[model samples]
Target: MTLFTELRRRKVFRVAAAYAVMAWLLLQVADILLDNFGAPEWVFKSFTVLLVLGFLPAVILAWVFDLTPGGLQRTPDAAPAETGVTADSGMAGREQLTNRVILVGALLIIVVMATERIWFAGRGNALDLPAAAPAAGLAEPDGPPAAADPARSIAVLAFEDLSPEGDQAYFAEGISEELLNLLARSEGFRVAARTSSFKFKGSDADIGEIGQALNVETVLEGSVRKAGDQVRITAQLIEVDSGFHIWSDTYDRRLENIFSVQDEIASAIVRALQLELDVGVETAGRTENVAAYDLYLRGRQLGREPSRAGLLRAIEHFEEALTLDPRFAAAYSGIAEAWVWLEDYGGVPSTEAYPKAEQAARRAIALDPQSAEAHAAMAFVRQRYYNDAVGAARSFERTLELNPNYVTAYNNYGDVLRDMGNLERMIEVHRKAVELDPLSVFMRTRLASKYIDVIRFDAARELLDEVLAEYPDNDYAKEELANLAVAQGRLADAIPEYRLVHFSRPGDPFSAAMIAIVATRLDDRALAGAWIEAARQQGENNRWELLARRPLVERDGDWAAMAELGRVTPGPEGALLRGTAAARAGDWLEARRLLLEALQLDGYDATQPARLSHMRTLTELAWVEQQLGLEDWEDRAAVVEAVVEELRRQGAGSIDENGVSPDYVMARLAAMRGDRAGTLAGLQAVWDARFLSHWFLATDPVLTPWREDPEFIALAEQVRAHAASERAKLAGLEVLP
Candidate 1:
């Protein structure tokens, strides 16, 4: 007999086919289960390896063994001449039995798969909502998780521009965003954030995949066409699971009636979803002028671009829109957002940008009291610019009340909370923002930075790893990783991460500035000088240059130059830095005056590295008071103690940033109080954590008394030697300059 015929008779082919099919199905099930259970990659890799290794063994066993109804038996060799009726009858009976067994196994697998789908659906494996209830002001404290009503969640995709020239893409996006905003305002409905939803624009992703990515149950998508004074919009709401149309509509309207058309579409969606009429949307902050609306949309799209030039252009478009429609509240809010970002991201001075932002935000609020975007912008300005925490908090609360799904409000409010020294509340607010916009690398990285500040190293690393895995080239993610290393006192690991960010964003001065500061802290003056020159070459005369120069100036004991440099710097940082330099220069009266002015300008900022600066200012002010024999030194020392106590209460007592630590302040206080044991203990803790900068340790006035102590001498020498060794490792490497 032919080899193929012999194999068929022995059922080897059937066994191989069944094994292949079963293995594929098993792999699919394994992938889902392993991912859901958060299994490590090695576990799945080993499972796959074992399965592949077993394939040959499984086929060999099929060749060697056979099943019989009467008893267990090895497969009998095929007979050369079995031409009898009984032989044919026996073969047919065995074949029927084998088929029945295969059928039962397949059905069992199907049943298991179906049950798993239902089980995971109930546990929110598909929706991927946070297990904890959001404690941000938008939600009740410790309320049920938002996942409980994930069935009501929806994503609004960017509508396709079907205009003849395809030049109305921005208009189409604006319509979709407006609808998204209106739906998000609904009381009980959950709408995905714009950043997460718009990521699928022009993608070939199916509705189900988009829904899964955004963690939504429904998807709204459409096409828009505009020609002269007429507009046509077609929209459909699709059920993600079934890929079925839940509702659809097409509208042909004059351009002037676009606002009403949006209102009607939003109301129809609410009705189709069976949402209450009381929770329906209102057409607030909308303009009737089509030309102005187009300009507003263009401005918003440009504002999202991550560049200074783009922001400047966006402001121009927003101004044009406002000129065409003076009462365009949304346009004013857009302008406010652009100005705020110009300072925070685009290298503009806060003095120049914050006022413009506040003015535009005020105009928007005046035009429409219920505009959530307006309130959010004002809140950002109040906190980040004016440092008015109470006003910012109230504005954030009102913004959330108007639109509970305003992700930016939650994000900025989290910053306000951080500035107020409420780390726990800040994290809570950030979590809510992440839940609303989970795919935003910016939000995730920002939260990771807070984790680093609080010394939650593992949590911070996990978030950064997740972001880097998807966005390998993200400069912000790399910077945060470097920040994490610095917080942990891993100076060696941090330098390369900062360099990576510098290389990726060669035109940005921020990373070069960081590298210079880090090199100075390591006592690598040559490398520091190279990076400083590189930063200067970046061409923007921003705060980074002054910041990068401070440490090098202090290292040289050129207090006069340091003070002069700080005077030119802006804000409380500059004042405090100038004050510290003046004190080191023996100008106690000038130091005290500058320090008090600094405190008056901004009481305190509880976020790193600003927190470190604040701590430094208070410590130096206390020391200056002691030099001038002022009793107020006691009050400043008391305030420092209170801040330290608060940090301990928050479980972040060990927080360190860029070689600065609260322990340094405590050690100084101990020495001032003549507590030798406490002073040594604090110094030991700082040494153990590698949180000492060599120059600061060498020059500190409080430490002058301990200079003769053998242990203190050894600690300082060890830190100096470590910094020298780390610097020596890069001795011959070419630097930026």
Candidate 2:
């Protein structure tokens, strides 16, 4: 008799019950993992189908292996030994066919999965939200700064976990990072980067020392520890410059005290910072289970770098926790977080994975209404999808309210602010991020570089001094500082900085570009040509990739090079370079065409507001119009009018030919059109608004036409004197007699 028939006759349902239980347990774990880590519904659905398919074989295996009354069956040929050879011969043919069918089916499944994975390799394995959230007008905190003021700077130092024996090391570290991460969700604090904190990993540096190093006023530190089913935590706040530990705390609770810990720690830090929160602050989704929280932490530690293998491993650990406790909210959030990284950098396309990513984000949010992670995930989706700035700003704000010292939130906040032309404030935000993460080389260099963009050279120099003093080998900082030197027309001074940076990074584009510009200025044609060639080979240019193109493009004879540059580079400037090249080649039509296309691509971001909206976009637009043979005063005035009318519709005003600010661009546009009064009006408005020179107008190619006109030249002199007067007013500078 067959082994299956024998087991059925012997009432072997008991073993079948055990198999079912095992399968059910595995299913439960799979369900939780799929929700958290984010995979297509088919993955889990297929599990059920597989389980059903495997049932007969599983029963057969169990029955064959079971110690039944009749004894174990070695194979399907369970006939007596005497008849075994003949019986086996008859059954082998059919058994071989069945086995071949099973093998082929399994192979097909493997092939399908492998093909799907390969097809979507570029997009990554995790899902992402298509865009950030719709920007709701979250009521502003009282007396929000109108712009990124230099005086307003904040930093968050890494919190120390002070548990006995460091038993709560992961918990303390996770909580601190999470809380800071949550706070970073907003554009409120100019928070520091995480790498900045690495140097203090084990140091008990006093707040005063840290403050001097990071240049910030507040520091937060905390710890976590657990004993059996109970947990304990201690938190403290210190005023950085004062070296005063203003507050301290200790808490004891059951194992399921995760929510309480997060809340207490966050509330303490917020109160210590003396900051207000949006209504959304109270929306942080709370979870109480410590076991699940621990597993979530384990997963997060893996995902911090955002790698594919790391994320898959994290998903496995999260699965283990879910096996023990199925309804784990934090675990789901961790899974969603992994998926986002996977989609962002893990080479997984949104088309295939976003549905999974969305499900996890939704699940986490549904489970915990106050999840900053959930909100942030949604915000990322919105950014990618709709390019909705207003919505991203609100979501980011809510994220900060939920956690007040998040560095990432601060970084993203600066991004949105920069989009609005708040360069000074963007510099401040990056400064805050560097302070929070004092050991972060990238943040410090980036912050210092931003200061240079807005002509805050003194601030940039000061920051670079700090970086060079501590880590002289940092190439990005050294090279960027060289770029700053080049801006000041100090070719001699800039040479050393470029050489130092090039020595370290070898073929770094920023160094190459700067070297090329400075070399050409110094009359070293060989070095300049060498740099030009190297920059092209090194490959750089993006929002983050400032291809040293700026200095080269500004130099004469490089217009031809710009066409080459445009061909290789990406984004707005690529188009701008092509247009500029066409113009220099005497093809104004082509130049105008390309520039107009760039204007369309940039849309709202191309406009400058502080100058009242007459910035590069309008200037370029005006240039195109003028070159197209509409150079008369009446035609110029008409161009300004069209731009002004558009700005007015957007609740903004015009600036000048150059949209340094809306008002300024409009005024310049009006003046270029022969409206002397309009020119002065725009100039006066920008002056009053405290828009600094050394960055805009004078060197800006936008106002080339106006710079040649005598009437415009007279207005420019008046503005320079007026700016000096305004500086004196703001800072009480003395007018030397």
Candidate 3:
């Protein structure tokens, strides 16, 4: 018989066919299961090796064995009679078994293909699914949507360091960040902010959960192994909801080809997501020099820590990068960014740090005008230091134009809008920032602050509470909660909150000062004095010293010292302090001038009465006008009344608007008009709102007319009693609130 005919009779061909199909099926299943479990690539290699080894053994076994009615036997030993069949019958039986085996294998192959098709189709649909809307009431009406289209949204997680010593973590992170920046710069791609993505660096959280938190549909994760000049990068694009890999690749190249590897990974991702890459679009890597790139990445890693020492170290690294490659725009931008933080963290005076930052940023732009980081650095310097609101806005616009997914640009721009008294725009920008960086505590806190600015107290409280629950040690969120409580006239609630922050950051002058302010308001003079001393000891003679002394200025009549201190202060807050000092010293004319100057500095105008500080400034100005004379007070009083009424109509229903308790203003107005009932009513409101201090009611010049009234005395006692109870409660806390 022919060899093929002999093989068919023995069913070797059917067994080989079935073995091939089964091996393919097993490998497919193993590949998926191993990847899902995050098994090392070596595990897959081992699986493939075992499959190869089993193939020869299965073929040899099929050649040696035969099917018989009695039992299995060697092919040469089997005879038709011993098997209780004739040659034709035995051949027919073997043919039927072969046909059945072939049919079953074909069916299994079909089933496997169908299963794969179903899985891939489901994953594809998940990628295209519309993003889930933000929780109801969490989004503002005019704000940007909470999530972008899923097909175009992605989050690049920090890559793992698989180097021999596991010491290339910074290099892996830098590569991931570059990929994120590239995707962010790509048209129609919405990438999660660095802060949000890096939050999952060491976490074992499910990819689907991470995707939901960051508001992205796809996630790119990878690992890097570097040895000397050789580097291997393995990256995979995953459908977040299904946790299915859309594409995966490993690039083995020299360090000099790192930029090319990055480009290849980005292109692979674009293809996997079915995105159209724009022609001539630049990728994120700028420097071809590996040393300079490494230094720049280290600088960026250090810059994330917003501390004086951290920024200083970041600056050093960035400067070293510049020395290596002066034309590297990213390095220059990093220097500019580091300098901005240096100024912010009090590492350098704004006057010195800002100009240097502007110079570095301008140089970066000159080198690479399309750089989003360059534009963002310029915007930050202009907004925070130069106060050039128009220039800052233009820079911010250019920044977003270059990289629409730059969350920090949005966040910084929101601050500019806030400083310019554009609450709506501020809220809108901050909402977008939070959307892009949903897992970022800093971003969420900033959004909450904007919510508070718009008087959406419940929303602000909810957001702050959520952040605090997740990150209980977050001082910024705690501080915002305290501010919210103070704004609501809940001083007792605010005091404990501020004390928590104070105890946590005992050396932070701002925290100590806030505690001092709240303590004084609670009538705990000893506690207030202790905090004042604490603040003074912690560099209270510097630019931040004014905050530490503010409580004393308000409680005691220390106007002369405050005025001297204010002469060196520079900003709206400084002007307000000077005005208050002038007012307390009985210089109404100077107070009126300084107060108006303060209002102008704060961007206050009748047309924009929605500014949080506007009503407060107007109230102060009206009080100063009343002190000037009753004859000249009508115009000022009319203006204040008009603004207050406008704000009330705008939903700021609080009697105390943005920290200016209107009780003092109302009592002054009533006293001037000789309205006895109005005077008593205003005092009663003050007591109810916890705005009145016992010393102010007893000795203030404005309330002298009603000092002898029985009802006014009773209101003063009520305020004092309430203060005492709060003070006692605070004292019971172990933290010395």
Candidate 4:
């Protein structure tokens, strides 16, 4: 008589239940498949919307129709006839069987859905998984583990700040980071670095998901409640696979005993993991003054924000911490780290910031000789500011030895390897850095750039595209994409990307300068002139301005202007370019002196934007050496032989470690050696690679002897034609506003 009874009699409830289970199952499978296949989010949303819309229709159809023993039939408004008839018994039996089947099917669907969720939770998006470990020697035993070891590998998530005001977040993070550092220093276990672990700070993802994402077996998480001078810290070490607590403890301590509490927590965690602490490894905090430590923690929290005001504020906090306890080595290290970022984020010149960073790093190291942060800071300064690769390498080695979980050290060390021209080693270290911090977009993009350096364009593009999909407006990734375009001779394509970058950062000298350079390559004089002026105004005579101007000078065959640009370019790249121009102007002795100066100032690999390859410098020097009949010509020739063999080993037309087209370098080397067959082979390879730099090809002194050759002239014409085609495309494109 009731509506509910009527619905039940028609089996609408059963149909609804079955439909719900089926819909849920479909959604689960769809989500997993779509995510794995890199489907657009809207596709999944539309699928869900369609399934929801179909639910009511399915129930309505069930209410209206029913399956009898012989065929489909309309459901009766009243209950089935209860009279003593054979048909009634058959109907009851059939109804019971249908109910049982529907119940069992729903259970199975639920089980299947749950299992899929569990499986996919353990394995995240399939496409995002990191590649396999590189060659054996690539990952050092001391670095973060490449694979999870249940007994040792762990991630220390950022601690929750449960203070009344919820303002002790920095204090809580400091405590968690201290535990992470202490665990990292202990032998026989792997600790995920802070960058990866803290990524799940406020995440709703469960333990298993975090573990799989971080590639760890266990996770350490806790909460901190601070009330004035007293603090209550609760810590628990959980087995990520099982979500079981391996060790848990609560500490109630005064502010002065915070260091002791950290040590106690570290000891308990180490004991629970059955690992012994290594002697001589650095312990918890470097200072006993809690006030100073609080300031240091605040400084560190702000330093993570990569902006000028935040970094400057971070420095102030660090300085205040130092004033509280002048002997706090960690605070000094924090200052050094802040200074390292000031050049990029705070717009401080490297000439001004690096010296201050070195001073702070030296002070930190002096106070605490075992300070890994101090060593890493010193290493970065040595690499970037002094161009002392050997010194930088030594410091980075010491840093990793002290704290092998240092992701930044690995990344910078990778750069050092790049500058040292050890392509394999550079790639290996970059892989290690990514292994340690899988969630870091910075690390991923840097590795992509390294792949670009070696002409691994597809791999680089894949990584960049993956990053862009997740972070659509990531300028760093976009910049690397532009770099890839340039490397592949897609100069016209690069201009739009550079325009996007410039739009994002309107006054960025590097992006503006890059736009100018690409515009010059495309022979768009109007675009080139506009961006060049923009770059000079914004660059304030920085290295980017120098690099951007060189292309214009080369386009005009102004060797004097090139030499003048080089005189003020500042780094080894300046000396190298100046030497090349000097050689072009018939001053072989001056060229030799400047070329040797370049060799003394920096390693063989050239920095980007300069577009001065080590091979270019070597070829120029070779010419100069022969022209002057220098005594070191034989040694130079031997070096040239080794370089030539190295280039050949990289495969023809590859981009070498310095981001130079190996084809271009090889062609220059062959021409310098006066081997006509090698020269032709190299030129053909260059043409195959489409390295159509018309100005460089036309005016390159190394290619002067080949100018009269028929094949060389043909290749030159091909380059000019390609350039003209690209120029037309550029002319048609709307200029950037």
Candidate 5:
């Protein structure tokens, strides 16, 4: 017999074919599962290696064995002439088995392919929203009626790095971000924020689902391959709902032509979306120096991470870029952004960093006056470091005018408005931010916090719950929920949530301090002490303030420590803390003097009246004036009353129309008037609202008159009972000692 006939007779060919089909299916399933689970590439490689290694054994087994009616048997050694009826019968049965195996394998292959298609057809396995309908107010961008809106929106997903070394991911990311920035600057084009757009990097999500999540009509995705000075970039813009390619291109060019490549990509997108480019609409790239541009891109990529180390690394790259090309406006803006973050994150004092940031930003504007990034950086410095509300507002407005779709400008402007006591306008700006970057966790969280600030608890809760569901481990979301619990008088409920935040982000002293503060309210002294120490040790910028407060909260009479804190701490915030310590020690005159000094500081007066520091200073000043029985007591009271009225008029208060709750302020005001009934009413309101700071309530001298009141005592006990009940609910969760 011929060798081919012999192989077929032995079922080796059928075995190989069946194995090949099964192996392909197995690899496909493995690839999908590994990618979904975020497994390492080696896992798939090993699986493929094992499959290849097993192929020879499988073929050898097939060649050595034969099928019969009863079971497998060795192939007969008999020659062709000597073969009997039994051999012929065995051959027929073997053929039947081969056909059955091939048929079943084919069906399985079809099933696997269908399953993959169905599973990934929508948002893939990452999200579990309904498949049929788009999110509220967002329609599919198929054409016609939906297209009549005329506003073209797009999200630029991070480009895949196709370089041979696989080390060019940052370059690919920078290119995608640059394209996004370019599109955002284009008028009438609404672009998703980088945080939201890049969240889908390496995801197998459908274009339609990504569009729905981001509330956009189109998505741009691409790959970048760099080899020496030559680069190839392939990009495609797809209409999300129809999955139609609106525009597609591949650019093969030298590194120096990178700016042109970006310009071409932006022009293609604008053309595809049918957006009208205004006269003198500037191209995105600001620098032609390839080396400087590369460094700038790296800096921009690193700056996205809002951590101290990340900011410092970004600063290094930005500085290097400037050294290569001193006129690079974007690079200067990058340096300013990193420095601002360094201060914001407490990596450096505001005094040291803000000046440098301001200088860098000014340099950027000097180089390119129309640079929105430079304007945005200047705005952040003015608002956060300088507390210059007017200057910040102007810069922010100018930034928005330069880049209408700049989401960060809207977010920062909302914050500035909030500080200025414009609650309605703050909410309006935040809503706009959400509209622009619908899928951003940071933006959503910011909006939710604003809702909480306005006492719109239900709305805030809905947003927070949605964020937690999408990102179960999000510390910011968890922290906000804890704050909400505190506001609602669920002290026990807030404790574990705060603990989770502290546990997850141990480097964040604020979380640790919050845990300690909440624990004091719950009368969990040991827990309070533990977290207080944790805060003191881990706290960077605000360590002394936290340490000083601990002695007062515990009533440990550690005046020497407070004195030392005053010596070390600088700025108005430190002055406020020292004043607080003096007030705690019954040194009213000293407290008043320190507080007045704080109010006169550059940081204090520049801050808005709505700020916590301003409110605390005013409240303390009022209390001191009442204690001194001065003729100006009424004047101080009038000032406090006017501020409260203004806050109310601005819609800036809480459930009691004064923010968080006005009960504490009302209680203080009533105490100043010796109105026992009014004081009790305010205290009751505070308790009912669940602003349970037991330590503060018990120790505050301003509330001394009500301390002996029977009704007040009863209310305090009720608050304790509520806290205990909430604690009981956390049976299995970790709790502070």
Candidate 6:
């Protein structure tokens, strides 16, 4: 028989095709990585697919011609009955087949090696640095403002593991993290991020290199040595710019005293940094029970999300910690937080969980007299469970006073302030959070979007752009970017970003909903339909019960689905879901009635209350209000505008609005009403926000009407100049992204 016929009989073609397909998959993966890491648009998925196709010819050649060994081992004529070969002969034939296989493998390896070496090498050099340098005023290691202040800039090095048993790595890491958190919580200090500082844990990076890398004025390093009940820790605070030891200490304590470790470390670090921390010695006493504290730590490590399973596990740990030391205030608070978290995450009823959260929080304070976590927990309960804004604010304030650098302090405080119409302070607080957690992609995104909330798209865009550049993989950024693009009428640019978001988080109903929205605009009915169906498949996702919330098409739908999830199925979020379903099902009045009923619960109800200020809820509420708009049309419209504006400003990241942002929506609405001035205002906001992509700004359809406006050009230039100035400030930075 012909070799081709023999190969067909042996199914060699199918085998070669399988290998080719695998090669193709690997090639696609490489392309995806490159794209995600900032590769050029010229890079195509089909490019990798074609690379696999290249192997097809070689594979087919092996099948078509019997030139390679092991090419046709399964010939039909070689059947055992027909060949009549003895066992010895069969063994000899197998040896020959093995030799053939080895030859084929060797050749294939060489081909793959050559292909990878040549094709992958040039792909890494995709980014093009601009010829013009960053503007003249860019700050670097040589002279950070913090360097001059000495009090604000700081770096935290890895703490030494004190445990002689050598299995306390998690403990040691937590200690360092807590110290970092303590410092981060303070408004008086500029603590480095976990990623930036932790990058040097076992590295040879000295104080000088670390200072330069972190761009800080002071560096803190310490070592821990613990044996059984006894522990010893030595720490030194060094001034990076001057290479001087600013403060030093060696501490010895019993393992049982680790309860006080968190507060003690915070005080020491503050003194070392020379900051005027209002918090002092008594604050350290707040960590009353070491055992309870340990339990809390163990609980934190148990679950990925705040689900009931994780919360239950966390509750056990927190309880144990408290049991080891009943006076442990934070442990009691931890138990409270865990229970409250479980209400939303574990799917328990608010009646069951909210009261528990409140009780636990109260117990913590009773036990410790002064617990930051306890205060925060109480605030959550009051806000979510009791609906007492005033009380919640008081507790939130207490938490901050106790620990100014608390990350959540700023977030929760800002949220409350916003509800009170204190937008300016809210922005300021979030700004502090962003500074403290510069490498926190999540915080930055929130900060940027908050800027948009006050109709300050310019600032929001700048922040969002920075977030996208540094953490392009963030679905939040991508969604906002897509929305911004669509707002600008740049459907082409907006589509890919939206699609990317849905693709990255296939099970995220919000993303799928956005994808559907964008697809509808782009006339991709099929894609839109497919995405909507997929969105329907993703269960409920939201957790909070709030009066106002970020505008979202899928929150009611998707989050309700999440409510049905085994964890958060029957809690406060579930109630919101039932309410949302009533609204979406065209029973607008019923929806309003249900939501109002849910709102009657306390602020401490926890989950949805925290995120209630979202524009989506406000917009829907406005619609419901409109259905009964006899008494307050102007007031209602104003409320709607505020909600819309707030949604527009969120996540802008210190820059102005872009195409996909809601600014375009307002601008268009104004234009349709012959509000030329308003249109111009929106257009100006978009241009001022340089955080968006050139592709998005250029392509979105929302801003199409504004394309000819003279103000647009001036605004764009101004934004670009501002961006240039900012980039110049980070010219020689390390890990601040």
Which model scores highest in lDDT?
A: 1
Q: lDDT, candidate 5, residue 288?
A: 75
- Mind giving the per-residue lDDT tens digits that candidate 3 earns over 1-737? 45676676566777788777778878878877866655655677698889889988888888898666668878774454443324668768777786787788778888867876664553542223222122121111232221233377999999999899998999999999988987887777799998899899889898999998888888999999999999988888787877876666566678888877787677656545656564125743377788998998888888887666677788899899888888999988998988887655432545567889999999999989889999999998877665566678899999999899999999999877754555567788999998889888989998887776566889999999899899997988988898787666677787667777766654445666667777777777787788777655554343344555655555675777778767765656667778878887789888989988887766565554334445556666777888776455666566666655554444443333223454556666777678889988877776665566776676456677888999888888887787787776665565353
Give the Cα lDDT of each candidate: 0.76, 0.56, 0.73, 0.75, 0.73, 0.56
Stronger candidate by TM-score (3 vs 6):
3
* Candidate 1 global lDDT: 0.76
Error of 4 at 328 (Å): 2.5
Locate the minimum summed-lDDT window of 10 residues in model 2.
125-134
Among all windows of 10 consecutive residues in model 5, the one with the lowest summed lDDT is 126-135
As a whole number from 0 to 100, the lDDT of residue 75 in candidate 3 is: 78
User: Which TM-score value belongs to model 4?
Assistant: 0.74
User: What does candidate 2's lDDT look like per residue over 1-737, in tens digits?
Assistant: 56556665333454455555556667768866754443435577699889878878877675556442356654453445432223255455754564565556556556756874564332221121111111222222243221111212344545556555666666667777666555454445645445554456688776677666666655666655666776665555555644444444555566665565566555544433444443245533433456666887888778765455787788777777777666666676667667655554453544434556666667766777666666665555444333355566677677656655555666667666555445456666776676566667667777766665555678879988888888877776787777666444444566677767655653234455556655544434555667666655543232212344444355445667779877654444567768867776778788877876665444444233322222354465565666677654344345556655545454332222112455665665665566666766776666554442422445445455567677656656654564344333323422111
Q: Which regions of candidate 5 fall more than 4 Å away from where they truly are?
A: 1-151, 241-244, 271-285, 343-356, 543-570, 581-593, 602-613, 626-631, 646-661, 719-737
Q: After superposition, how far is residue 638 of candidate 6 from its true place, in Å?
A: 6.9
**Judged by lDDT relative to the true structure, which candidate is superior, 3 or 5?**
3
lDDT of 4 at 162: 89
**What TM-score goes with each of the models?**
0.75, 0.47, 0.75, 0.74, 0.71, 0.52
Which tens-of-lDDT digit does each residue in 325-357 have in candidate 6?
Answer: 767676677777777666544535566778888
Better of 4 and 6 by TM-score: 4
For residue 362, model 5's alpha carbon misses the true position, in angstroms, by 3.9
The better candidate by lDDT, 2 or 4, is: 4
